[model samples]
Target: MSRMSTPAESLTRPDGSPIRVLVVDDEQTLADLLASALRYEGWEVTTAGTGRAAVRLAQELTPDVIVLDIMLPDFDGMEVMHRIHGHQPNVPVLFLTAKDAVEDRVAGLTAGGDDYVTKPFSLEEVVARLRALLRRSGASAEKPANVLEVGDLRMDEDSHEVWRGEDEIHLTATEFELLRYLMRNPRRVLSKPQILDRVWNYDFGGQANIVELYISYLRRKIDKGREPMIHTMRGVGYVLKPAVAQ
Candidate 1:
């Protein structure tokens, strides 16, 4: 099960730097999950577990956007936002509130928050919200090409078209997604579990064999009759790299 596809246009700062984000939440697990999701979008993410930490990190990072939880161990998120806004007045904030806490949601927005998400939100929702906030803040004005390339292989993410050297290769949706993941992290070995979570959106459980199946499928289409770009490491995992011409 593939995760939700990101926006077609990759967002970056005017100077082409990764978008900076600050995530503040007392729940360590939730904070880590949000940070992972944001980093997957190619943004820089910093996490803080308390209001004081949030304020301090905000000042240090001067982040482009913030995801703040309303309840914190130290002084509450409102106070943290106030202190951060004192120095970074123009930074956008997206608040996290409990699903039943309507008052907290209203207060957060009234207190200058730019957006809010209830608890138990999906990672995709948070990522989408943060992207919208970044766009609205005018912090990310550069839209990088929606293409991935390694050596002579090219993939148009928006068009979902693939090419190997001069030959256009047709791929199924799953094959395209698998190839996209490999192309995104060229030369980096990806374990079966990682591929399952990212591409299949599930735990390993007993499904490791599926990764091998897909790798074989991709190889026949992408590597057959050409210099091989996908390679397996015994007892490790798999990697995709540029083919070395003989």
Candidate 2:
């Protein structure tokens, strides 16, 4: 951690080191883009094009964060996530899936994916989410109280507001709660039941549709015309991930 960092960097190890990230995807171009974006953010970055290679690299050089794609040429991303977890359970995994299907999302969650993003994503959003994840993980990255910035998206927890650059984002009470939860945890998968418990009153007897409706509302407002951030996990729940690779 202290090896590849410096002072003045926002998120770094306690010794003032840059956060290191490993990106796993089959698409060389997409992985390169994400690696470049992360590196530009002052974090050390690496890439792996297959599950086996990803696992091997992670073992040899541990990274603070891992951006994993669900689909892979050798083993699937889910399996790769498992192997990584087997090696290091506490490490955070942010999934890069093609879609927000319930099955894929649940599988990733069950397999221990911390967070994820769908395809055709904005690099800015991906960067923001990664930074936020590092902050939440307390992985010697950033402080929790610090303002979280992902691309143009910014949220000041102390102020309880979100902004896309200079423009402010208007959110309903429920929307605010949902977004807050997602931001707080960053890349961790929050199941529907889990989200309900966290966001709404535990005793409140709301239908699942409430969760679905809120997700739709959030997507429409937060991700419309940009990239899908909040996503659905069929037969499971929802997650906030980065843009998925094609």
lDDT of each: 0.79, 0.71
Best by the TM-score measure: 2
Highest-lDDT candidate: 1
RMSD of 2: 15.2
lDDT of candidate 2 at residue 177, scale 0 to 100: 61
Q: Could you tell me which residue pairs clash in candidate 1? A: 1-200
Q: Number of clashes in model 2?
A: 15
For candidate 2, the TM-score is 0.57
lDDT of 1 by residue, 188-233 (tens): 9999988877764545354577678778878999999888999998
- Each candidate's number of clashing pairs is 1, 15
Q: How far is candidate 1 from the true structure (C-alpha RMSD, Å)?
A: 16.1
* Whole-structure CA lDDT of model 2: 0.71
